[model samples]
Target: MYQYDNYDQAMVDARVAEFRDQVARRLEGKLTEEQFRPLRLMNGLYLQLHAYMLRVAVPYGTLSGKQMRMLGHIARKYDRGYGHFTTRQNIQYNWIKLSDAPDILADLASVEMHAIQTSGNCIRNISSDQYAGVAADEVADPRPWAELLRQWSSFHPEFSYLPRKFKIAVIASAQDRAAMRLHDIGLELVKKDGVIGARVFVGGGMGRTPIVAPEINAFITEDEIISYVEACLRVYNRYGRRDNKYKARIKILVHELGVEEYRRQVAEEFAHMKALGLNPPREELARIAAHFATPAYESGLSDDLDRSDPDFALWVDRNVTAHKQPGYAIANISLKPIGGIPGDASADQIELMADLAERYSLDELRVTHAQNIVLPYVKKADLYALWKELEANGLGEPNLDLVTDIIACPGLDYCSLANARSIPVAQKIASRFASNGRDAEIGELKLKISGCINACGHHHAGHIGILGVDRKGTENYQLLLGGSGAEDCSLGTITGPGFDENGIVDAVEKATDLYLRERTEGERFLDTYRRLGMAPFKEAIYG
Candidate 1:
């Protein structure tokens, strides 16, 4: 719900004009592919396996109905008739024409959105809790902090190109909906002594070398968070490896330096940054915070819901969360339809989601880290009607956090970095669990799939993770267990050996079967895995 001012509008429009010139030059053969790679990447364009892909930034996963409608338009007119919402809370169009990139960006800029910083070595999109303002237990909305950091890092001269790509996530609630600890810098806003401060975690990432971010600062005042973050980045940028891409992440540097030494260097940098007055004035934060003011709510609204319809009641139970506002609910729209792609929403579905946001969610929509859409403030009275509309449009699925609700990256189908196909694997596994009604029985399983070890799909953080690998020129899948991206975050461990496509799906079911058989009362797959560890699950999966 943050509208772009004249300055913001000017910046985006200028970028569009600049990129148009660049694209024209490339098409005219004045620039070669190598010459255009970094330039195009800076604008969030990628040369995929089949065609060019464009990633549009959804800052902190917040957008208005107008912005969401424009995304649908871009998907419909420029690329194919669909867009893949990514784990970064961004959207990607796989079949893009190089010539149409500028037009698409222009269209995005019209709605106060741009693809800036969605790619390249600069700080990627500053993500936050999808339920930032609506969550009942949050200390404060995290969007303002996200936006402030966004403005600071957009084109910072010092951090234009880091050793590797950087990611940051902010969360206000105790729950880790944004996978805070998995980001390069994770900030959890906590209220202590009646003042909101941030608990900072640095150097966390998932890739070939997965690492849980170590706590750098136990608590830094809210006013000084920006300065603190800048300090942390300064240290990483100075010493982080640049020669080897595999060892270039801040996580690697932090691991080598040790947490204590990293903290010490950051403290020195923070001291210098504080004197330079890098943080914007208090009024600037207040100005940014003003843009995210809560919408007006109706007084004396009834909190009653009609549970006569079993399907509607089931959807409400699985796909909705309690809103801080009375008589309102946070409705989740699942993109993972049985046997369908996990995050690909057709242009029509996107437009319909935009309509629902305007009509029911105070003109705002949020994209979750799990690659789902969320209407943050749906009225309780409107649940049935909303569910009916979503069901008719194939958007209603009561499988939130269930076995069928999978998270997958664009594997060999789209990504050049992928070693195997992820979409087919995700599809088969979802269908395998859904056909026998087993998905409903196995509850709260966070399943994730990645085509390679880059871990773009976050396989390292799933309760049940599948990694696609190249085994002797054949696509093989590795099963992982006991991973989680929640408040209790931990990396999953690999099972014995790899399995072929169908074999892997069966292996996942076997792992789940062990959980179902061994779990105590009310234990989810993750809880059961932790309680029993990997021994039984490995035995079940391998045997």
Candidate 2:
């Protein structure tokens, strides 16, 4: 995990102090809600339906054991003993008091974490693949570059106010776990002619108008990434729609300008920035890279370790993945319980995970985009014992990449923008599929639920996407077919009419059952859908 340097530490400490003063002023009636809204948002505080929600950024989803423990402490001390991990690889405390937010920021800063730019119109947290450093197929780790961008964008004077919020994701692997195509700016690390480079995708995003990202440039040299990104931002900041908030995202800009014109404008801006010497400092990048070198590895594993346990095999198969190092595995902790809330971990669960991360795995933890926790490096020989501990703590759910692994948003229950309750919808759908006893039978189906058009649940990328809409004050869900969150990502197509809350789960089951019958041998839901197209599933589901 990357620790904060003097500059990082100093900036956060100052922000905390400043926010503390701002909170005092607001409470004393010196600042109005309108006056204080932007300030609070910049500090990651949101005034939600019933209370204030504070979002804490877990950069590229990586956390130290100590940092994880501190989050648990904060959950116990300031919140309702739980936190919700979001799609952007961040955590949200939904019941924070306005008065206690500054103290929360201060505590987080002490642990080398801060909520800065977790919200508002500035460049948000720079995200990368959760398996960045350890994935065997990676061309290079993308976290150092993410951190470098984080430093450069933090409180950037020019881009602080944009037409709307912006997001950026970086990936260094052939597999796109971070959903790079769904971001405003997506960068893929590549190598060309013996030189390291990046493939840049600008004006790619998801929301009401979902567009699969288009390639702006196939290969951008490593030295030009910063300037190129700045160019993209400048073009958007200048030409994006400002009349309507819904049309302000970079995706809309891409839609209106057409890909070619957008690319040309960004290129023009990049040349100008280069002429002005506005590129990110290479020395600063080198400094950030030093903080994320590979962790210390032990030479040998115990020869007398148990390997025949069925529980161990299940855990190894479902919760663990291949690691870059031999004899080690990357353990993924599923946040989805059969019918439980997605991404909500109690304080005790958090403590137990922190303990496990420190004791068995490397002293590192990560929150994943799929709303799960990851222990990046666990020894294979220790799988059984670790599984036992995790089961005891209610954190051992071996359902990764399965139907129960649902991605859901905190819908009408918390979000004012939501049209319906997403969590309950997710819970019911998960329960229905579990009842059918076909969770494993279905295999590797991503079911995403979003409450509204914002697409926070990434409904556009699910193998089966459910979108909640307000139909005459009644909760109705619109089904979409053939969405995929993979290397060849595509937006789902609408199936038919919306279903009521209770009817929605059954509808999803119908779709899945259709897949079980129509799929070719050993084919995933996505492959089956592609092979047969949306018509087969749509006819089965709708009819």
Candidate 3:
């Protein structure tokens, strides 16, 4: 909900004009495809397998209803009638035409949104907890810091081109909803002696090599956060690998340097940055923080849900979360509806969601990294009516973190870099686990699938991870177990062998069956896996 200032508006408008000219030149043959590649990528345009794809940034996953409505308009007018919400909380249009790229961007700029840094080696969109301002456990809202970083990093000359792309995530709650440890840089807001500060985690990422970020600083005062972050980035920018593209992320650099050495280097750089006065002034941070003030919540609304309807009760239990405000709840809108595509929303559905948000959720909505939307401030008394509207519009499915709620990527179906198809595999697995009673019995399970080792689906963080691969020109999948993307972060270990598509689905079912048999009371699949280790599950999956 940060409103663009006059300066912000002017900058976006200027960028749109610049891109329009660039697109015209490309179309007129003044610029070849090779010449325009980086230019296009800098603006979040990519040439995929079938068509051009455009990724638009959703800063810290927060948006106004008007912004959501514009997204719906773009989906309907520019590309296909739907858009894909990604694991990074951005949205993508998969069937874009080069000719309409500028127009699409212009429309986005009209609403103060853009595709800048959504791709490219620059700092990508900063992410944070979807329940940022309203989470009961939060020490402070992380979005203000995330937004500050966004402004500081945008078009930064020093970091315009790093060895590889960089990502940052901020989390204020004890629960790591933003996958804090899996980011290049993670900041956890902590309080001591009534003063809020940051705990910095460095060099965590997921790709071919997945590593959880190690804590670099136990506490840095909020006033010095930008200095510390700049120090970390400067260190990585200077010494991170340029020899090999595959080994270019900060995680690789940290791995090679050892955490102790990396911490030492960062400390040295932080001292220099501080001496040079690179940190933003406290007043500037206070100014940015003012934009994210909590909404005027109504008093005396009911905290109790009218759960007389079993379906409503089920949906409430599965989809609603406790809110910091009294008589209000955070409602998660499930994009994964039974066997549908995991993170896609049609124009109509998008518009309907926007309208619903405007009417009920204080005109604000949040995109979750798990590919769902959050109505962050819904009154409990209005729950049933909102549920009815959402269900009617095909936007209501009560599987929040259940087995069938799978996270998957745009695999071989759209991504040229993909070696195998992920959507069908996700579809089949969700179908296999579609029984409501069975899913409820199974409890919370995180299943993620990726088309390749790029880990776009965050397979490394799932309780059950499936990575699609091409073996002798045939699609095969590798299964992994015991990974999580929470505060207790760990990478999954692979099972014995890869499986064909059907074999993988059957294998997942078998693995779940084994879990059900072995699990003690109150243990989720992840807990059970940690308790029993991979031996029994490996036997069940491979044997």
Model 2 Cα lDDT, one tens digit per residue, 242-349? 899989999889878999999999889988988999877778777788888888877675434365877777767778888888778888988898899999999988
Off by over 4 Å in 1: none
The local distance difference test score of each candidate is: 0.93, 0.88, 0.93
**Most lDDT-accurate candidate:** 3
Among all windows of 10 consecutive residues in model 3, the one with the lowest summed lDDT is 432-441
What TM-score, to 2 decimals, does candidate 2 have? 0.98
Q: How accurate is candidate 1 locally (lDDT)?
A: 0.93
By the lDDT metric, which is better: model 1 or model 2?
Answer: 1
lDDT, model 1, position 542? 74
Per-candidate TM-scores read 0.99, 0.98, 0.99
Model 2 clashing residue pairs (backbone): none
